[model samples]
Target: MLDAPEVEELTPPVRTLMGPGPSDVHPRVLRAMGTPLVGHLDPTFIDLMDEVQELLRYAFQTENQWTIPISGTGSAAMEAAFANLVEPGDTVLVPTNGYFGYRMASMAERAGGSVVTVDAPWGKPLDPADVQDAFDTHQPDVFGFVHAETSTGVRQPNVSDLTAIAHAHDAFVIADTVTSLGGVELRVDAWDIDVAYSGGQKCLSCPPGASPLTLSDRAMDRVLSRENPVRSWYLDLSQLEGYWGDDRSYHHTAPITNVYALREALRLVAEEGIEARWNRHRRVAQSLVDGLADIGLERYADEEYWLPSLNTVSVPDHVDDGQIIDRLLNEYDLEIAGGLGDLAGDVFRIGCMGHSARPANVQYLLAALDDTLEIETPKTQ
Candidate 1:
């Protein structure tokens, strides 16, 4: 066996995640993940799945019957939403403000749909008039956009306005709530979001495998009426519903550990109450903004479009973005990410998600950032 390549036992150093995702998992969730593994179809496990669905509904603040966790990560949930909803030759309008928006456009194209893009600068919200103009120009079969533009820390305000515009044009809406669901204010039912999906890692304070998704009756009707079969067998929501819904049939084996972690995370959300959790995120985010300003850093997005859960800071002209971030990782062992696409290296993304939103964690990041920046700048006096 070639001596098994001289394998050595390894232990991972503890990390404080202050980046885009996989935020620090709570102790309760970690304990839950260690529970004995049970067969996916076992009655007990099925019961837990039902509870998971219910908890997801609560977390999403929606009574939609189709709420369930997709087995893969958040991206899989995003694919499933578009695949099931967009038919071949259908025109789908997508907003181009950040990285995920482009991913949405690509997925729609793969589904054989024609795409029309409504765009804004990276750090701004999609203008309702622009979406209206697209509706007038394309007359799309469906429309979608990101609730929180994670790449630039911009949250679309008055989201219901977009929904109204789409509805007026008789089109369905797919809302990407991956980074906003638990950390920001999202109302699937009240906002009339037809299909919405979110990840467990960011603000849910769970491991990264589980993603929560919900579809309204109108979206489900479109899926049932589609002439062509869903492009993905694994991601086929109609078939997956039998397993995730009433029949509770066997499909793929669920990620038992991830499911356990999600259950505890959702429980924590419910226990804290949704509104209270939103308030906590907002308060911590304000403190983070203040701290960044104190260290002479500037936020990228305007205050009107800023997302409380994730903040994008503009790097000073003389400061080398990568060097400072590297120092933080090597010296303080904190994790933060640089920007994406057009804005890369011009900004730094610091996430104040879930458990990482605690004041102490924010304070640690603030102090480390101040010290790192001071050391990196040359002494003049």
Candidate 2:
């Protein structure tokens, strides 16, 4: 008989998540996740499903009946958006401004889209003129842009203008709000965004596995009328409608715990008031920026498009980013991340989001960062 391997009891570090996401989960949401689960198709679970959808609508600021939480992570919701909307040979325009834009292009192509780009530097938001020029040149069937880009810490300004441009060109608009949905200002219906998707681990301060997604009626109509079925069987919105829509039938076993956590998280949003939450993020992140500036760290993104949820601080020429990051994690139990793509090695990504956005966390981060940099600095002559 094979010997049984001895395993230790589970213990994870208590981390202060000031990174790009999975920001400190609210205590209430964490408690919800620990509650006993109901069978996915049980009457009680079905009623909970209705509550989840309603709460998601409130968080996304949409009246779309099609709003629901995808069963997996943010990427699942992202794939659902692209797979449902991009048919074979469809011309899909995606921004080249940040990391998630590249992800969008890959998903669109996998969905049988012919991808094209609207050019912009990594740390800058898509300019209206560039987007318009891309539409005029490519005449894309669908256009996708990042509303709050995590990689570059740039918030796309003039979102309504971008949507208007897409509509005028007779193209559908999809907004990537993974980093913005609950932390920053986003209005799906009023802004005329055709579709939008987000992760629970970001501003929602909930664990991963249930991501928010919503679609306007026109976008849903296009998905329902697709000549070819969506590329991925699991992500097909029309079939998902069987479960999330009026039928409330079984598509796949829902992530009951994630749904519970998301419901509680969105309830916090309603209690706090969405606009007030947005302002709180702005206020808290402003403190982070002020502290960084005092320590001689400059912001990578311009103020006009700076994402309040994710702040990219330029690393000092003498400071090794990896060293500082490790020290913060190991010594301070604080978590912040490094930049990606074009900005890698040039900046550190410090997130002030959700439950982690409190003043105490920000001040703690600043003090820890100050110590990390000071210890590593060379002795003055």
Task: Give lDDT tens digits, candidate 2, residues 1-381.
Answer: 999999999999999999998899999999999999889999998898899888889888999999999989999999999999999999999999899999999999999999999999999889999999999999999999999999999999999999999999889999999999888999999999999999999999999999999998999999999999997888899999999887878898889999999999999999999999999999999999999999999999999999999999998888888889988999999999999999988899999889998999999999999999988654223
Prediction 2 TM-score vs. true: 0.98
Clashes by residue pair, model 2: none
TM-score of every candidate: 0.97, 0.98
Candidate 2: list runs displaced more than 4 Å: 1-3, 377-381
Error of model 1, residue 23, in angstroms:
0.7
Compared with the true structure, the alpha-carbon lDDT of candidate 1 equals 0.91
